[model samples]
Target: MQKEGQKSSKYDFEFKGGKNNSYVFETNYDITYEVKFKPSSYLFDERYQFSSQVFEMVIAVTESKNLDDKIPPDGLIMFTIAEIVTDFFKNRERIIVYICDTADARHLARARKFGLWFEKFKTTQFMKVDASITDEMGVIYMNALILHRENPYFVEIIDAFRKVTGGYSEDK
Candidate 1:
């Protein structure tokens, strides 16, 4: 793993925090979440208690330790996996879920039916992704919550993240 202040080049980063950050295992999912930040994602850390993962460089919130039910959604940053789940459960009407990936139709259909549980999200599209790590294989996804946010409060999460990580340039 790269050390502190190591120049950001082309390295695959997975989303993880808290004690789980110590892990190095990979997931079998296809979607890649491009979590944008203000700068080089430097402010967010384990304190937020968010557990995340990535297909390539894009990070996704898989779990959280600290969660608030009433908070409005911004762009979702610096939060725990618990918070994301709580927010989703609390406001199912306003949130839309998206499960993105580069898996084939058979894999995708199986995942959708056996793995994902959805309450919102009117449509889902599966696309092919080009990841530098493995073969040119990956998935890029765009998902918006059902609730429209005139002012995204969670965007701050991304801002802080870019600051801490030192460089936040991610691929689409």
Candidate 2:
């Protein structure tokens, strides 16, 4: 946000926490993939589909400091991303819960019942959701998965922050 007297500066690259986009997923042997919000937004901000409110997280890792080779190549982006995300959530008690995945039949089946899933993780906290939508060409390339809160604790944090600071990242 621009300050009372300061002007807004342009950013070099735009981030992807925006609204209304489609994606897919695909797999073969001992599968796993991530529904990275590329900056994971508040999971249900879109799922519940409220027009006025876009409760988002600062999911962008492409901050200048992140330009280092820490970004692993494509396909392996998950391991690096998961590490960062896990560590990030650790710092803020505000982020109450997170769900990750490992694709398998039993977990997939459970996801149909529970809503999210992580194969490496025991079926304790997360409910697995299978996102293998194959089309005529082959396996599904884009899967639009939603990571929502069965509990709204994260939302409470967002609301509280808004109440206190009104979305400005820092004081001028």
Candidate 3:
């Protein structure tokens, strides 16, 4: 039970300032994860180009050196991620786009897990919109756009995301 106005996660994390806007944290199993928020405004340029900040959030296992490692479930990981997201929203007008990795064909599962996390930890100040599409090769891509509720370009951002996703709206 996180108190209002308090950070979501009880775990500690550090922001590794670099080209990719990375944040790092370690789990109890000694597994290290790096969460990167990369600029992805180009995805919206074709639809609704705006100055509002947009980024793609990518979470990967580092240090372990093996993407196939069978890591045990760590609830703290979600807390750390929620904490990072809380910090990122300090600007109050940014958007985060998260596309699940499809290398193992578990994109849907990943998206579901992320959606659960967002539903669990998301505050009232934020909103999430989900979209899914199958590419020409029939690869399903699942993504979510998270943004601050008070963002000045809220309508534009949602409209742009809808356009980018071929008029798909989760609300509809």
Candidate 4:
């Protein structure tokens, strides 16, 4: 946890750049995580005629050889994520889409935890919007889009997302 008045980055674990726009970091618990930003503009291109930059942010546990149980809460994990996001926004304007994994049937819980992390660590220059949809199979998918507040196509991007998600509401 960060002390009062301390920057969030101060608590971030050291992370290194990985192949294909991925960031790799290891937690104090010895769990390795890989955060990747995969090109995903195809998701919006055909439907919305959109031509801007968009990536699907995927975070996964890359190596957990020593772990045999569920991972515990680690504040540094959120800090590391925040740092990677900050780095991603430094160069250009882009949209990051995060869809929680539903394989374990805990996607809602994952989404809630992600929401808490974003709410606690997001900077003033950042903005996030969330949406949820139920597929024909009755599986619910929760997703979030994060972007710089100064993005040129901010309004259009949000609109495209809303249209794709069946006009789902935004988060305040």
Tell me, by lDDT, which candidate is best. 3
lDDT (tens digit, per residue) of candidate 2 on 87-131? 333323323222223333343433332232133322232222223
Candidate 4 backbone overlaps, count: 0
Clashes of each: 30, 14, 0, 0
Per-candidate TM equals 0.20, 0.26, 0.87, 0.86
lDDT of 3 by residue, 6-121 (tens): 45445568899687789987765567788998987787784454543888999998876333678877677887788899898898777899999999999999999998998888
For model 4, give the 10-residue run with minimal summed lDDT.
10-19
User: Whose lDDT is higher: candidate 1's or candidate 4's?
Assistant: 4
Question: How does each model score on lDDT?
Answer: 0.28, 0.30, 0.81, 0.79
Instruction: For model 1, state the Cα shift of residue 51 in Å.
Output: 6.7
Off by over 4 Å in 4: 1-19, 46-52
Q: Candidate 1 vs. truth: CA RMSD?
A: 18.2
What are the root-mean-square deviations of the candidates from the true structure over C-alphas?
18.2, 16.6, 4.9, 3.9
Model 4: how far is 29 from its true place, Å?
Answer: 1.1
For TM-score, candidate 1 versus 3, the one ahead is 3
The TM-score between candidate 4 and the true structure equals: 0.86
* Number of the candidate with higher lDDT, 2 or 4: 4
